[model samples]
Target: MIRDVAVLALEGSHAFELGVFCEVFGIDRSDDALPGYDFALVSATGDSVSTRHGFDVRTPHGLERLSSADLICVPAYDLRVRQPDRLAHELRAAAERGARVLSICTGAFLLGEAGLLDGRRCTTHWRYTDELARRHPRARVESDVLYVDQDPIITGAGTAAGVDTCLHVVRREHGSAVANTIARRMVAAPHREGGQRQYRERPQPREGTGSLAPVLGWIEANLDQNLTVEAMARHAHLSPRTFARRFQQEAGTTPLQWLTGQRVLLAQHHLETTDDPITAIARCTGLGTVDNLRHHFVRRLGITPQGYRRAFRAPHNK
Candidate 1:
């Protein structure tokens, strides 16, 4: 029933986050055995708008297109700009008429500006949680989750979390099968759990400009291996305590927590893409046993691994 989607590219938008909307909703997936969404990029003026990334995007439709949309997305934009009364009015009008309104990253700032977030539970990027709260005292800003869907109003965390939000919308609208299909085609994991709390730890600064990037890359590639803090610290030529601290600083989480999250992500990818049995996938992802994976998957994603697989797997595969 969610046929038409309209994304509002406000002035000073972030290109990558806006592109997330397009990639999830605008791209045609019918050729790949998935349903397609009718998506449009619109602006207030129906003109070319510049993004924070130094690129311009053109929108043929103006605010008028928002009236007929089943869903509306507002990508991140500069909050310092003077909010136009007319634009805020239109956004509220659309939401009042039953169109689902979503915001990606700092786009929640606009919703706050429009007064839509007042008394509603929402979230924004972790970096802006304080600011969002300070600006709109009535809005309850949840900084932990990747996204919050308060029925018709939804808000996502920063950057890549926008993809999760969009796919979530797809899942809620069409079904998990369609959303997972699209995620596979895009080479993105269909689900992440435990919210942005997992990303709140500050990573250590680079060791004398040597860059922890290589170390992080190595960890990702060797996720299946026993990745104890001692072993990882030995690899980095640091004491276990220092390594743990640095890992948290560099990776934004303790090594164990980060590893668990990565393994969970890998498990989710396998659940959505491969026909491998849960036991096999669990072993491959270093999750020990099917029971263990099931526990963690359920705890994190709010569903058992089998249930997730059943919801996302193609009919024939299921």
Candidate 2:
């Protein structure tokens, strides 16, 4: 249901973070059978805003663009200076009017300044979690998760984690197929496993970096196959315990967790794209039984298969 998206450009905003919003929401991907956003960059103060990298980002749009936006995104910025009161006021008002608000990295500070983060479960860059907590004592700052989705407000941790949060929103609104297509175009993971806590212990993988790419590719291709820890361990040439540990280290999730998530995603694709019965879709996705599929779908997505199809199935397909 989300269509229009407006990204807020503020003084000293991080260029990469802003680019993350543009890349995810501003691009035209309809050629690839993906939905295109009615996207625009809006500045609160003027036509041009300065970035932390000593460059200015110029946009034709202004705060007025935000009024009709279905979602408003605020990217990371230097939080040392005060944000314009008008920007904060309008952001809070937008959320009040049922517009979802998303913040990347330290942009959570802007939400706190807007008083939107107060009494909500939120998070930010791990480096600033304590500061965010201290600044807004009323806000429950979770330092561990990749992102926290408290309905109207979604918060991403740092730079690339923004991708995870955005794709998550897409998956929630559309379906995994759309989200995964977008992820494929971006060459980013369709889903990430762990939290910033895991990243804190080690460096994040650089772009085009992943140790288990081959195994993961194999698993994805074989989602309907019976995959077990022992089977996957053999494929990865590691013992079961070693593979489990290495998988967590490399993928940020346990093997079974990843497999179940894949099955759910596969089930979602079937529900959205095919008129197959729930039992048939469950079997195709490797959930084995309709009850098993129902259990995982409801537990993970909070929606029954029929309900999800009702919401996201393509009109022509339906």
TM-score of each: 0.69, 0.89
Which candidate has the highest TM-score of all? Answer: 2
Candidate 2 accuracy as TM-score = 0.89
For model 2, the stretches where C-alpha displacement exceeds 4 angstroms are 193-211
> How does each model score on lDDT?
0.81, 0.86
Question: Tens digits of per-residue lDDT for model 2 on 230-285?
Answer: 99989978899998887777666678988998898888888899899998998878
RMSD of each: 5.1, 2.9
lDDT of candidate 1 over 1-318, digit per residue (tens): 578999998888988889899988888877877777678889988987878777889998988999999899999887766556777788899889998899988899888878899999999988899999999999999987788887689999988888888888887565556777788988986655425442645543445565566676778888878788888778878899988877666655568877887788788777877899899988988888999899888776667988878776656655
Error of 1 at 118 (Å): 4.2
